[model samples]
Target: MSILKRDQGGVPRADPLGDAAGTTALVLALNKPVYPVYVWFLAESAFQLSLLTALSMPLYLVVWYVSRIGNSRAARLGLVIVGVLDTLAIALIFGRESETLAFLFACLVLSGFAFYRCEVWLSRGLVAAIFFLFVLAESLIGGPLTPITAGDMQNLAYLNITGAAALVAFIALRFPRQERMG
Candidate 1:
């Protein structure tokens, strides 16, 4: 059997969700290292944000490994949890001014696409979690963890908005399409 067509056991290898998850993991991992350098370049004061991004790399690797083993649901859950937590961390660290909350919206969209129809409940729960985090960030969290000038905050905001938009677009493009019925 062709390697592309089968696993070592000769079973057909077909796991769209797993493939998507693995690809997401790889993309995130590859891009994550740049965040710190980029943030430092933008504002040395905001370097902590880069550290937070760096910390999330291990979680992405875990997601990749889970997907590689064909545990798509676990990988999906890992991605949602990691994305939600990472966005929340940025919000809490930089406060609302950084505009990092935009990433939470991306997380919400990610949760929606990460699961299938049969896993609707899981998807809903993840969406709710994202919403809850958004509310907590907007209402409960106040002020930046460290003092950052308005200009620095604005730079971070631009970075965040662009990052969130890219994340949402990636999710839309990478996930498998579903048939629509009239």
Candidate 2:
């Protein structure tokens, strides 16, 4: 049903980078997605967002190491290390705040990348299925999502639920199969 296309390798061909519809592009955009909530939750919103946002900090360090070491393999290893660390940080956030919707979004991002990294390294279809599930879950349940207030958390639960449905629809269109491989 989707428009984005993929090669037999399960790789998207639209982006010269074989992005599968910019999965890497959006995945790296943590600051943009979590920013509005960061503005709303402000300082009191626990360091969850801050921690997750810092996942990209290693880019600089990896750049330095890769430049000095002159090894792509080391750079890749650095990336894997960062992904694992980010996963731990996200899991910690998820463990502490299951009720928080922002935390759920963060979990989705972290878990998605974890799956991506695993699939690329392990060469397994099951991991691809897990990645697909994360995309499907986000596409279905993630969008301009946030928990406005304590009151909203309970009485306005429908708001988040509907927002999630909208997200699913948007992603359905946004990351179509046809656009993936060109």
Q: Which one wins on TM-score?
A: 1
How do the residues 76-172 of candidate 2 rate in per-residue lDDT, one tens digit apiece? 3333345434434443433222222432343233223322222354424433544554444434433212333443333224433444344444434
TM-score of each: 0.85, 0.35
Provide the lowest-lDDT 10-residue window in model 1: 1-10
- Which ranges of candidate 2 are over 4 A from the true structure? 1-20, 27-45, 57-88, 94-96, 99-124, 127-170, 178-182
Candidate 1 lDDT, 64-162, residue by residue in tens: 999998876688788878877877776888888888899888778778876666567778888897898798778887778889878888898898899
What's the C-alpha lDDT at position 99 in model 2?
Answer: 28
- The regions of model 1 sitting more than 4 angstroms off are 1-13, 179-182
lDDT of each: 0.77, 0.37
Model 2 / residue 158 / CA error / Å: 11
